[model samples]
Target: MSTPDPGDIEPPRDPRAAFAELSKIMLGEQPLSATLERVAQLAKQTIPGAADVSVTLLQDGEVASAAFTGPLAAQLDRQYEAGFGPCMDAATSGTTITIDDTAHSRRYPDFARAAARKGVRHTMSIGLPVQRQTIGALNLYGTDDVPFDEATQELATAFASYAAVAVANAGVYASTATLAANLQRALESRAVIDQAKGILMARHPGMSADAAFDLLSKQSQLSNRKLRDIAAELVDEVQRGGQD
Candidate 1:
């Protein structure tokens, strides 16, 4: 699900508690998706008049929904499909977008219309600073007019500031995981190829290690298969022959 279930969200006792919880989430070992979902849920609990919350992330020049709470994802989807909204403007321009009442909003007529249809009366979008630039936005939606006061907006901004660092760290962790997997695969391929080469050398009199490897490479090229695959097949065939 795009948005987190309300039952999963724990209400914080106060702003201090909310900040502490957010810090814990940042330092936790949970994956990026879980961390982002928790951040959105916390935003809903921490901000007054916030019926829903969503995080819009911009990665590789593409905008995507990272996490959300309540039915906010559906509302954000309408804004994205229409190609313009407060959330989009917030991320792109590195500025805050706020509307006290969707019915009276003229800056984003289409977005206002869609949010009004969705029973959203007030909204706030704050840009998230990532490193040296703004890379995302934290969005809050209210069902009543003027749901967020100035204090609420300031608190949301502080949360977004810390969230930016957490998001960037998650990206780095994901990349490291992928690199580690690839390296492990490469090591396995090398070990199998070496074993196949040793088998070839032992089976043929006067055959050098390099010649055996060349033979395996030629077979791989002629069969249009991976070198690792050809090496594995040779090793299996040798084992079967020995057994017989």
Candidate 2:
């Protein structure tokens, strides 16, 4: 299949429509990475003079590009391997960092040189703030030396807000799904353990449920296995014997 170009996608000009598009992507069943990729593509399409766009995420105290429009955008983001690039700075400090002319930028000499060598003359990074905390950055690159105008910068900032909301909502949804799955597994394990306990009680007429559980626990410890696994094994063996 051919790769889809960001330029081919219709840009959402209105802020409300842009946010609705982002929300639709986030609310879908796709993974967070895919959603972030779509966000990057949307930003590239919406921002005028933007040659490329990337989403930089600070996960577990490490900064990395979570999504990008193309290889150039991803390469430029990684040029700051020392964790001192505009993208990293924006994400860490929760501020917008712009390099109007990469060749003349003194704030990040190394990154500027690298970006210039990669044909990127101007760049902007807007921090993605979620719930009073900065989680990432939205980075834009331009081949032209001209900096983004004030109005364009404002649009980028607004789009960053939408991206931040998408990230926050996606995180909450993922956490909720994980918790529900864990609870379901816990319930299933309890039911199986209870069945094993009943089997032990049936074998020993005077054994209480507590005693039966203790017996299973002892076997689990001696066998160097999980309590659940031990109970499952015993239950399976009894069922197979009954079938025979």
Candidate 3:
């Protein structure tokens, strides 16, 4: 579903302003960690009562990276190791979970204690995916016990959705780059195989190149050896014959 239906809440009057900010982040040259740092910094700086923001990355069933600004950011690793925080559950569930008042909730005693000790009043988490698979979460903390109005929560989520796309796009681009490199390597290997067949054809004159290649293929299959290895041996034999 689109983050916020228009009927739910109209965006800021200068809707363009919010989008301009998002575009600037994607197009910027700074590293992604720097970009996430800026995202949190700007959110806390702009939003009323927002005390902190953090961007977390999960890969191979573990947290891979994280970036945050302010005191709350520093405490994230502790919560992760303790295994009792809203962000971890949200990342695993792939949903947004909110705790407006930690004191009353019976769930996650350890996290509640940590939040109380940290003076956290309210918190929210937005799950992000590297693709279809859940991989990370974005968390926001407020110092006052102010549950987000449905509208505010949605706007924040809309922005988080953008963050997820930015992260996933980087991953897809990297995977495609690796595939390109591998395909190039395979093409070069095939060229060598063709070169080996030519050498065999010349050594066994009157034999067609296709027929010579078949001989190598049959020998490789019968001996249960790799075709490349057999080709190498044939080339070596021709070289040794020349020396003799």
Candidate 4:
């Protein structure tokens, strides 16, 4: 379960550089998908024997492939459809799944055979956990028979952890943006509705606010339109009359 010292392995990219790159991506203004796509590409460069890479993301009870380095997208899609494979296990179980040699692997036999046919002999899936639940996985596929040693596993885990932070931050940003948009729309709708009510009251002297609102509601129901839409139309009509 131990690997040779890092000095002995000629990794594709320096682990430190990989982490620094991830940190930069996380801090950038890029969206969640862009960050994960960069992460998958960095993983392929950082892992010693990585031939392909893909990110598996789960949000709102649906699982999907977020990004990939190669034809691994098709491979991952097959696993999703079948509900099997190391990526699925990692994301659902929150545990890293490693297959050193697909030809001799008993776990995920079908996946192993399929991967082997695609020249992927070694594979690993590291869970990306957020808020106590695994939300995604960072998957690595290699065309070598060598097992991923402890150091490699550790590197992959680090990559996934950083990716998880990025995912969480992106989720928060998206939610905040959606909330702001909804609030702005609500405010705009309210302003128009109020304007419509004011016009109704002014046009019909002695009409109460409640009665004016009732008029708008009746018009909305009769026209099969939403109250807001009807309100907007009334406000537009008042503005047009003002110009005339």
Candidate 5:
């Protein structure tokens, strides 16, 4: 006699499909920042009561939100600015912190009040532990007063574990790539500098290698350029002169 509204019908929960999608994300070639953003969105989709989701990362003693699904999730920024909240506590302590009712939360009263003002009534932060260290947190916010049940909490924890591994691997890959790039540039700079020094020494018969290097450094300082750049320019000029 009555038709159910499509908006009122809950979407089917397919944990397997969600995990499959996460696995594909891990295998994708996206950068760490994009990967984390997708992870936050995925968490919001996979978790039943998640009104919003955010990923908080702690680096060099600074806490910041790396990714978030909605404005409510971005509220974690206020916690980061204040230096204390469920997200920060979870990340620092490697523990899951839950606020069933933000209006009545005693642990982080200030953040609770702030979140309540934004219509957030429930929140949870799961520590993202990597290599035995807590590097960040996966945070969830809900507008409803009802707390996440034990089953939902367990599912969230499992999803967080998977996301943590992906994040750690991406971090390692990024660091290694940066190191390799730096090493390559260093080697190239050394080669060009050596060539420049040889050219200068050939021009000034008694010029020592150290003296030639000092000349390059002087030019670099005067021009406000890097020593490597100056050396490369000198080498290029010598080659061009020879060709002419």
Candidate 6:
């Protein structure tokens, strides 16, 4: 019920500079593991009282991919395996959960034991969603016992929002790649059609390849056909004439 203290932490002095760094880090040219490592770096430098972070993606409350910041991540996997922790609660309940001190926290017994072993005394987690679909959670860990103050919580929330957008952008990048591939294939097919046209034109000295192709294209269009069909017809005609 108590709000976090915003005054405890300061927002980035230069939002543009922060974004510039994030943009470089978000570049998808590298492998997902490399990209995720950069994401963790951004989270570490931007968030206060956070020595490490972990990002876990979820689909229907099941973990799809999990990336850790460092040593903390390996330790936290135990909590996930225990099947009782803030991560699950945030994903299923669609709520932001914070723990002041896992040592004394009674909410998730298994989580506390694991946290104790890992030396993570505090945590703040925000659930990520898209149109009522709880996709995953952005979970942050700290050594502080009092948990995230207002400033820290806001920063975490912003990071989580960016994370959600980054995931969507990744999907967009994939779609763009697929479209590019299709475009290339269409171009290659067109190239083959042109070559077939040239072969047809060479057999008839008075006609040029371009003129022949134009004629074939016009015929195909008039007949409501594909250019490949016209090109195939010309190729078959040339082959039969060569035998004669």
Each model's lDDT comes to 0.71, 0.76, 0.60, 0.72, 0.74, 0.61
lDDT of 2 at 100: 90
Task: Give lDDT: candidate 3, residue 127.
Answer: 87
Per-residue accuracy of model 4 over 1-244 as CA lDDT, tens digit each = 1112224334588878878766665443776666767888888888887767888776555556666765443333447657677888888888999998888789788888767655677889999987899887888877755778999898888878877887667656666555345335544665787798899999899998756766776676577666778899988987898899
Candidate 6 TM-score to native: 0.58
Q: What is the TM-score of each candidate against the true structure?
A: 0.64, 0.64, 0.58, 0.64, 0.66, 0.58
User: What is the lDDT for 237 in model 2?
Assistant: 97
Lowest summed lDDT across 10 adjacent residues in model 1 is found at: 1-10
Error of 3 at 114 (Å): 1.0
lDDT of 1 by residue, 1-244 (tens): 1222334444544767767776665433777666777878778787766777888776555555666664344334446645678888888877888988888788987787767756677789998887678877889887754557888788888888877777666655656564344335545666787899898898898998656766776676577676778899988998898899
Error of 2 at 86 (Å): 0.7
lDDT of 5: 0.74
Give the per-residue lDDT of model 6 (tens digit) for 1-244.
1112334433434434545654554435654444545666667657777656776556434553255565454345435544667876776665788888878887876787666555677887777655666556767777655677998787777776666555544434555555345335444545666667788677678887545655665676477666666677767787798899
- Specify the poorest-scoring 10-residue window by lDDT in model 5: 1-10
Q: Name the lDDT of candidate 4.
A: 0.72
Question: For candidate 5, lDDT tens digit of each residue in 74-172?
Answer: 433456656678888898888998989878988888898877766677888999988789878999887665788898899999888888887776666
For model 5, the superposed segments whose C-alpha errors exceed 4 Å read 1-13, 26-28, 176-244
Question: Considering only N, C-alpha and C atoms within 3 Å, which residue pairs clash in candidate 2?
Answer: none
Off by over 4 Å in 4: 1-11, 26-28, 176-244
The C-alpha RMSD of each candidate to the native structure, in angstroms, is 18.2, 18.3, 22.2, 19.3, 17.9, 22.5
| Sort by TM-score, top down from the best | 5, 2, 4, 1, 3, 6
Number of the top-ranking candidate, with TM-score as the measure: 5
Number of the candidate with higher lDDT, 1 or 6: 1
Best by lDDT: 2
lDDT of 3 by residue, 9-68 (tens): 222334345445655554335544555565555555544445667776665555522566
